[model samples]
Target: MRWALVLALTAAYPLIVYFSLGHVEPRYLALLLLVLGGLRWLAGGAQVVQARWVALAALLLAASTALLNTSVPLKLYPVLVNAVLLIVFGLSLVRGPSAAERIARLQEPDLDARGVAYTRRVTQAWCGFFVLNGGIALVTALWASEEAWALYNGLISYVLIGTLMGGEWLLRRHLRARHARLQA
Candidate 1:
């Protein structure tokens, strides 16, 4: 329940900022984000390297927003999220058992060498995705209008993420079927 609330709040953050802008002060929004960050950090987000870095970045953004009394910091949240994700996924490629491999293991504990390689490639693809997504996010935050920022961060980005995940799932299914036929 706690994690669900946190996730929901985080997902709705862009819209929240967009709607609240001009009506509510940016500092108050920053306070809300700071509280959310604290909740996530306390709720075991700090246990993982990726989650911890994301939480820390969010906290820093919130603090900057509060101090500067500007919406720029608040808008930079999505950019930071993409950056943190990129770093985490990219690092996993350098280390053993890439992020996708770790996730694949949850479903298939006895992943073969082929599976490991596939997951590693998937992890690399995610790194590429993060780079492109993060660049767009940075552009939206810096020069785009508030509506454009909200539209991309709130709607378009999620659609793109879903598309990537769905595409990957389809490809994995096809590969699995081909491997099964070959083995048979």
Candidate 2:
């Protein structure tokens, strides 16, 4: 489906960059692709507004990060290119789905209400994390220091870890509530 294609493209970018550039680190590229591919998979499966938005935000942030990588030195061209791509990705995600669409999907008889709510909350947290990470990256790009890059990268990794934890928590809470409701 569309999600599979997006995931493939996301994975391909890093490989292409590594093979073509020959200077880019394979580990970094692989990590980026893995994160992006995972985000796309999550977004496609998301049934709540918050989860969808969070996945979208993560995707945009990842794309922006990739674009920024192309301009570590004094290169205005890569920055401009990345900026445009970021805008495109942002607009596409926003226009693609509405909260109503997610809500409708969640309203199915077989759907667990608590699970949907938790998904929404976790997605919102992810959106916040990505926004913060992107802002830090932008600031670091302007300042241009090795310390800045290190700090930004570290923060991004922390955000991703936090997101995973939040997701797990949400799933657990949802299951607990579902169990209680069923008992009642």
Candidate achieving the largest TM-score: 1
Model 2: CA > 4 A from native: 1-110, 154-167, 170-184
* TM-score, structure 2 vs. true: 0.38
lDDT of 1: 0.88
Q: How many clashing pairs per prediction, in order?
A: 0, 0
lDDT of 1 by residue, 1-184 (tens): 7678877887899999999999998988998778777767766543365666677888999999999899999999888878988888888899777999999999999999999999999999999999998899899999999999999999999999999999999999999999899999
TM-scores across all candidates?
A: 0.94, 0.38
Q: Per-residue lDDT tens digits of candidate 2, residues 1-184? A: 6567654654344234334344654334534544654655565553344335434554554555466654342212123323434443344346633232354366553545655565455445445544555565566656756444444443444556577777666866777888889999
Candidate 1, residue 37: lDDT: 78
Best by lDDT: 1
Clashing residue pairs, backbone N/CA/C < 3 A, model 1: none
Which residue ranges in model 1 land beyond 4 Å of their true spot? none
In model 2, the worst 10-residue window by lDDT is 73-82
